[model samples]
Target: MQYAQLGRTGATVSRLVLGTMNFGPHTSEEDSFAIMDRALEQGVTFVDTANVYGGKDHRGRTEEIVGRWLARTGKRDEIVLATKVFGEMGPGKNDRGLSALNIRRAVDASLRRLQTDHIDLYQMHHVDRSAPWEEIWQAMDLLVAQGKISYVGSSNFAGWHIAQANETASRRGSLRLVSEQSLYNLLSRSIELEVLPAAEHYGLGVIPWSPLSGGKLGGRREDGVRRRAADRRHDPADLTEQLERWETFCEERDLTPGQAALAWLLHRPGVLGPIIGPRTMEQLDSAIEAVDIVLSEEDLAALDEIFPGPGGPAPEAYAW
Candidate 1:
């Protein structure tokens, strides 16, 4: 459990963040508690969750499960608990988005469900295009002043959105986004086109979510093909060919595809860490292996050749 600064902030966090998205829907509460216990035992102090996580019908169940774990273990101060906003957690018009009202209402609800007085990191689950930055920052500022949250972050945001957010926060003399949670994996490198660059420029730690591409790179080659097929983004035949090449490379290096994939993210520049939402204790233990698995120059180059990202950052990615 190597530790590093969370972006430019003075605070430190573990390289392997424990994500609790699967706590309620896929995993039983007992298993969830056990998994978290194991992670904490192994020094995974950074735990992430969201208020809207528990499957469609049970939006707050995941947080409730986490709250119970915190209460039962009495480790609230030991863990850096993070969660998200900007999701529909209710049926009202003011239930979602980054409006001041929603952000205020959302944080209180999250605190209750998480059973924590303050969120270590509160993130915007998605970009709320309609919400003005002034309004959003105002709400966030209030929380900070009230001691409801320590830091703010963003997830699933475009490169431009990252720029927009920080620029606004800067104007308000606020400590802008300290970290970014984006979809980045061997199968999806779209963020490399701009998001990574923006985060680096703004000094936000890059935390890659779904680092396995929803199990595509988790030694389960078929998941990649099946998921891609549903979106019709790539021909199934081409995707299979790619996955076979990837598997062969992993085998030659005596690595599970999961290990190699995680190691790749660990090696990426500006990446603080990748989020690991393990459904079982074994999965959590397996992910921990990559934290120590060093990928050399050759290994990284080979991975890039196998899963070439969006060319590079734009406008170079698109032009000269």
Candidate 2:
């Protein structure tokens, strides 16, 4: 796998990041371990997980699983470990958000669960509109000072909000976001209008989630769509209706919907990497193959012609 620098951070990461959202709950533990092992063997050294994934009851099972695997494998120094915070952990009101107190509490919990002292990249899962940027950055700064987190990032944040946070960090000389994790796929292009440009402008590495459009682009039935009608994981109500036009466009281009979709995003200039979560080794193999497939200018033009803006008749926010 090709490696690139993670934004302005000195650390380098593989072009593909192995996401563990399905590790604990949806996927069996055995399958998770096999996937982890295969990814490492295949040279994918960047592994990302969140605190909320592992188990329905225990939480942090995904990280714990990684910790155990790393311990047994004795390859802790071989991979770049990245994880997130800000999702609600339990019933308590303070169990979530990016406030200083909650950030402190959350980092300690994450460290214990991951079986590691320093996180390579610690990210805010989403913007906490309730908290000031100062509060969030201060908490992140403390983690850096304590050697708990090496670098910080943001996810699910708007361009304006990220700009504000960058400004705050620049003035205060705190650790700024070195990267961003957000949804970007063939079927979803909303980030291109705002987030992508912002990341490019600020020199932030853009780690796009759902490069396959959550399996929809891969010509698979999106299971998440069946689970939640309004699920952004697969079919956003407005965007799904637009899929007909998109699929037709892909067909005319002589490309499978999945290939066409991933190719378009991969060709975009600022994209640093894509997070692809495949349940089976076969699915994983197919997605990794996308790295080798190149799209022509005509193919890209054809896709751009399908939905030039926010996609279909949907408002931009309807996607995320």
Candidate 3:
């Protein structure tokens, strides 16, 4: 697998990141371990998880399983471990958000669960509008000084949120956010309007989540499987037509829909890598192969004709 520098940081990461959202929820412990083993063998060393993963009843079970794998294989140093905070982990009111108190408690909990002394990247799972950036960055800065987390990142944040947070860090001379994890796929290109540009302008690595649109672009509709629910902002019939055209386009290029979809994200500007959350070994293997499927200019034009993004970006996509 090819490795690229994560944003402006000196550290490099795999082109494909292994997401562990399904670790203990949809996949069993044995299967998760096998999938991770295969991933390392295939050279995918960037792994992402969250403190609120696992399942409804098994909140931290996923991290526990990953911790076990790390302990058994002694591969902790071989992987770039990433996890998220700002999610409710217990019954207390302070169990969530970016408040300094919650951040302090959350990092310790995550470290204990993952069986690691430091997290390579600790991200805010979502923007806490109520918490001031001063408190947030101060907490993260403390973690950095304590060698608890090396880098900070954000997930599911709006464009302005990235700017505001980074600006605050800049003023404070604290470590700014180095990466962003956003939902961007063949069916969901809304991030192009502002998020992608903000990330590029700030020199942040864009790690796209759900690059397959939750199986909508996986080519299952030909077998009569319905499209994963419509986005409400779009017409169902229009989306169905788009998917049909996309599937045909992939077939014409001799690519699986999943591969074509992933390749599109791989070639997008400002994208570091797309997170591949595979439940089984086969899925994992298929996702890794997408890195080699290069899309031509004509192929990208055809894709645009099928599922167009927000024209270009911001005002240029709308006004002058």
lDDT against the true structure, per candidate, is 0.90, 0.79, 0.92
True-vs-predicted CA distance for residue 85, candidate 3, Å: 0.4
What's each prediction's TM-score? 0.95, 0.87, 0.96
Local accuracy of candidate 2 as per-residue lDDT tens digits, 149-248 = 9999889888887899899999999758889999887656778777887888888999988776665555424462322222365445566546667767
Name the lDDT value of residue 175 in candidate 2.
58
Residue pairs that clash (backbone atoms under 3 angstroms), model 3: none
Residue pairs in collision within model 1:
none
Clashes of each: 0, 2, 0
Residue-level lDDT for 192 in candidate 1:
90
Q: By TM-score, how accurate is candidate 3?
A: 0.96
Best by TM-score: 3
lDDT string, candidate 3, 1-320, tens digits = 88899888999999899999989989999999999999999999899999999898979999999999999899999999999999899999999999999999999998999999999999999999899999999999999999999999999999999999999999999879999999998778999999999999988999999888776778865576865744444455667778888878987889999888889999999999999999999899999999999999999999888888889889799897
Question: Model 1 misses residue 308 by how many Å?
Answer: 1.0
User: Model 2 — TM-score against the truth?
Assistant: 0.87
Clashing pairs in 2: 54-62, 217-258
In what order do the candidates fall by lDDT, top score first?
3, 1, 2
